[model samples]
Target: MKRVLFSAPSVRRLLLAALACLSSPAPASDRIQIVTEELPPYNMTEDGRLTGMSTEVVQAVLEEVGVQANIQSMPWARAYDIALNSENVLIYSIARTRQREQLFKWVGIVAPMRWHLYSLPQRNIQLRRLDDARRYQIATVKQDAGEQHLLARGFAIGKNLQSSNKYAHNYEKLTLGRVDLWIANELNARYLARRAGAEVPVPVLSLPDLADDDGLSMAFSLQTSDALVERFRQGLKTVRDNGTYATIAKRWL
Candidate 1:
């Protein structure tokens, strides 16, 4: 069984921090700037713009609560760097890890990301235990939680393949005898697989569910005002209650 490091206690701490931010004063009313990568089933680009479940949920909630929002897309690593250095900035659907737990003010962890791995079924590759993955050349996106997990466990990964949306090319690499394993979110990997017609059945290894605690969060800067973050949080709640989140997720997933 894969043990998820972030459980109830750490999640409660993050929530408490969010609550504290919610009760404080906001700095300015300019616009909340959010940055995300162009990844599918979470954040994807259409017509050269970012639109997906996480994006739609956040945008709808902020609009509903009367707060202005500006969203942009960049590479995942670059987006994270921008969010860290820039003010009035946030990132979405970010996994909670030891490195990121205390980095920023947080809000609206909509749901836990169900993560897994895929390998050719005929190869009989299985990862019932994380230790079983050490021998294979695991491939994942740069700066993703899946990579982080494997690295922490001392798994030596393969070469840097190309960067494509949703690890689609990685799946192709595996199919064409280029890689041993592909690590990504369950829903996201499946979506990408169908998009590429890589219908070769692959084994998926399930990880722990973190819905009650380690779901997606909008991580804000320390300098951002509390009131504005509170507004977005409340707006996210309104969107969820009003079924905007569910609707968008249904349409996409």
Candidate 2:
């Protein structure tokens, strides 16, 4: 084949076209927004950057799939809402409950936390099951998984459920007797308690009847593509197999 030499104007046009193609914005699907709450050791903002166990795992997953992550630190309620309505959005360290099973496409179960009802040791509270404790006032983080779980179980607000925006406030509420019981994750409760300088007394009730294996997964919006979700699933497995997951978990857990 004979080579055709380009004229000056043709060369300029070709160069400009190439430059435009190179500088064009990446497709929206190539970038994903990850929303997470400030739950210590799992997901939180440190020094103005998102970093935690779940965060690290998410980062590793994104790296494996070769996608960019735009992480946002927000309240759990707001993040949960965004994940429900937004496309190409991800919410990490969320409880995978039966009520939420069909709402989102799950990547993988990243962590497991035992749910519990905590109270002061001196109170001598007694509960054989979650229902028995329903008569007493319970403090929960607003829009948290525990709060949603309680609501699904018919725990009425203002009657038995007390809501707080911050997780630490629930601890304070429990300690001050503002609420009879505080519903929280086992690890998160201990972490927040130590941070708040509050003592969570013994005799805590494990909510096995409620959720024996409460899995925390990075859930994607329903609008997310199956291919994208599968990519993340494989990425998670890769990290776990390559020991990246364990390394990150050790640092935070």
Query: Candidate 1 on 16-85: residue-level lDDT in tens?
Result: 9999999865446646677887667678888877777788877787678766667887777777777778
Q: What C-alpha lDDT do the candidate models reach, one value each? A: 0.70, 0.84
Candidate 2 residue spans exceeding 4 A from truth? 1-9, 209-214
On residues 1-253, what C-alpha lDDT tens digit does candidate 2 reach at each position? 9999999999999999999999987676777888988887688777988877788889899889888868898888899999999999989888877778899998887876778888888898988888898889999888887888899989988999999787778888889889899988878887877777767655467866454245678889998988889989999999999999888878767
Candidate 2 Cα lDDT to native: 0.84
Count: clashes, candidate 2: 0
Q: List the residue pairs that clash in candidate 2.
A: none
How much lDDT does candidate 1 score?
0.70
RMSD values, in order shown: 16.3, 2.0
Return the top candidate by lDDT.
2
Candidate 2's TM-score reads 0.92
